[model samples]
Target: MSGDAVLDLAREGIWVMIIIGAPVMVVGLLVGVVIALFQALTQIQEMTLVFVPKILAIFVTLLLSLPFMGAILSGYMARIADMIVTGG
Candidate 1:
């Protein structure tokens, strides 16, 4: 493949990664912020308090987004495989 083709593949790979990860990252960020605010208001300051909820929330989000994520990943993989097969 040409350098431009390689670069395009790399760029597309990164875009796919971002698209797949964005939901989880966004959920984690929102959960963390809410937990922070709650902690501030209640002054609990428990370490596990911060971790458990975020983990659970992200896990739930991951579960919910699994199909969407799978489709995206599969599509990317198919594109890559097609490129490989066609000798691009």
Candidate 2:
């Protein structure tokens, strides 16, 4: 394939990755922020306090978003497969 085609594929792959990962990341970020705020207010400076909630929130978000993520990934895979088949 040409350089342009390769670059386009790379760009699309990156976008797909971002899209698929956004939900869990966003959840983690939000949970971490809230936990930080709570810790600050309560003066509970425990290092481990930051991890569990963020992990649980991210995990729940991942579980909830699994189908959507899967669909996006499958679509991307299909597009890549098509591009390969059609000799992009």
Candidate 3:
């Protein structure tokens, strides 16, 4: 393919990656900030307190978001397949 085509594909790949990862990252960030604030307020300062909840929250968020993520990836793959079939 031409350089422009390659670059377009690369850009789409990067955006797809970002779209897939954004939910998990955002959830984890929000949870971390809340946990940090709680720790600050209560002065608990326990390391596990911070990690366990964030991990669990992220896992749950991932589970909930799996269908949407799958759909996005599947759509991208389908597009790529179509492009290949069309010799683009």
Say which candidate scores most in lDDT. Answer: 1
Question: How many collisions per candidate?
Answer: 0, 0, 0
Count clashing residue pairs in model 3: 0
Which lDDT tens digits does candidate 3 get at residues 1-88?
Answer: 6888878989999999999999999999999999999999999888889889999999999999999999999999999898899888
Stretches > 4 Å off in candidate 3: none
- Sliding window of 10 residues with minimal summed lDDT for model 3: 1-10
lDDT per residue (tens digit) for residues 1-88 in model 1 = 8999999989999999999999999999999999999999999888788899999999999999999999999999999999999999
Q: For candidate 2, lDDT tens digit of each residue in 1-88? A: 8999899989999999999988988888889899999999999999999998888888889889999999999999999899899998
What is the Cα-based TM-score of model 1? Answer: 0.95
lDDT of each: 0.95, 0.92, 0.94
Runs in model 2 deviating more than 4 A are none
| Model 3, CA-based lDDT | 0.94
Runs off by more than 4 Å, candidate 1 = none
> How close to the true structure is residue 75 of candidate 1, measured as C-alpha lDDT?
96
